[model samples]
Target: MTQSTPSAQRRSNLKHRAILDAAAQAVAQQGYAAVTIEGVAALAGVGKQTIYRWWSSKAALLVEVYSDLVSRQALTPRSNGSLEQRLTGLLSALFRLYRSSSAGAILTGLIGEASRDEQVRAVLAEGLVVGRADIVTALVQAADASLNAQAVNEVVIAVVWQRLVLQPDSLDEAFAQHLAALALAAGRLS
Candidate 1:
């Protein structure tokens, strides 16, 4: 069962979401090379110390922005259906969320920065684990029909993530629906 977020935690999450929005916009407009914690603070209308107090580095802020943006969008379903249909809708929703320029730009900047900063990469991976796990859990629920399924299911999702994030390809709704079908089938969740 999902636990409810405490009020204090919810309030803190709201503040951080605002910061992420501001930071994402700053990075999207100025480029990662130009982004600074001070600039993010200024754009966010918060003190520089506030940003520094919460995050260790610009890369860390970016990672949090990406993670927060992904996490805010709940992945649960409103109706029951075949796994293929459910996963198709979920992937399509993910595509729609990531298609936002602000969020996409933040993720792109982090990925680019990670190539040059091993420390940033490790930190980002650690920070993103929970959000990634949440996403994986949604996929797991949809692919739970078959025995010996999880390994194949993860591979399918790995491919979908690569196609959507790494490759120079669009993640249109049609593509998401198609990938979801393949992934669910590959997981033997027909």
Candidate 2:
């Protein structure tokens, strides 16, 4: 009946991250459906109750893992490039993030599984919307033309993520740059 102390909490947090990483690796290799709480606990060398105590479901566990895995690098626009070039660089960074093997597969699977889980959908919506809005806000603040900012952001994010999640083969950095250039041109005209 002893209470856990602050150091024990920190250790528990570290164990939680290890569990999440192990879960991500398992999901990357075995796909989402095959990764159970027990499997992740076994992978992380922790107790199943430890996992359940922190995360209610595998989707919750994977979402944090996916976010951390994909977002370790900052996705800021380049300072030395033209608006189009900066946008292209941004797109390329995003392209690489989502297209990275573990993050990409886990994201796709999570989105699919999120269809059945409202909590996962909410988390996805919050993360994605904040990210997209942040990009658009940065563009506007960086003087990426005032008109049609929303449209421009939509086209860039859509093209990048569509290619990342759906058209993995036909899409490349070239295509993303081309799309960004077109969106920027159109935004300037508007």
Candidate 3:
């Protein structure tokens, strides 16, 4: 098969970015349940078939959108403080993202969709769960090699997931501090 030229590739990349942006905007404005391929396509100025060609389902599209949102936010761990302070800062940043933006709603919808769709479940697990755990694990291990990084990562992610799913409104600074302390405590025990 022949490869596309540079200009053609640029056009494709632009369209892809547009589609992701449109999907995110649609979800932010209409919510995940109200979004559709047709709506995203219309918002992106592309045909519905274009969206289908890139993504298999609404869940898949939303996952990409969510991923894009997270990456764009650049939520990596900071290195300017003590371990507990850094962890608390990172957790607080995550909580603020969830409470202040459409990311939270998009993630909640993806979780619900994952329950019923195997493909969605697999994608979510690979795209989100593993990546999040790895980030937390790396942060914990970097700060204190003696800490049980895996357990700490699991607890941090579990608390975040629980709050995101059950008590999103409670994702505040206080909760972030609590979670960070809990992670440190768990790490100390190990």
Give the worst 10-residue stretch by lDDT in candidate 2. 128-137
**Best-performing candidate as measured by lDDT:** 3
The RMSD of every model to the true structure, in order and in angstroms, is 5.6, 3.1, 1.6
Count clashes in each candidate, considering only residues at least 3 apart in sequence or on different chains. Answer: 0, 0, 0
lDDT of 3: 0.86
What is the C-alpha lDDT profile of model 2 across 1-190, one tens digit per residue? 9999999989988997899789878987898778888998998999999988877777777777776775675777787867778877877776676556577777677677667888878776666645446665577556744658877777765665566567766566897679878887667676
- Candidate 2 has an lDDT of 0.74
Off by over 4 Å in 1: 1-18, 142-153, 165-169
Candidate 3 residue spans exceeding 4 A from truth: none
What is the C-alpha lDDT profile of model 3 across 49-93, one tens digit per residue?
999999988887887888788788888889888888888888888
Off by over 4 Å in 2: 1-6, 185-190
* Candidate with maximal TM-score: 3
Better of 1 and 3 by TM-score: 3
lDDT of 1 by residue, 1-190 (tens): 9766798679667667667888878867887678898888888777888788789888888888776666677655435676667767877776777776555666666666777889877876677644465554555565474533454456555665566457635777888778766765666643
lDDT (0-100) at residue 18 of candidate 3? Answer: 98
Q: TM per model?
A: 0.75, 0.79, 0.92
- Tell me the RMSD of model 2 versus the true structure: 3.1
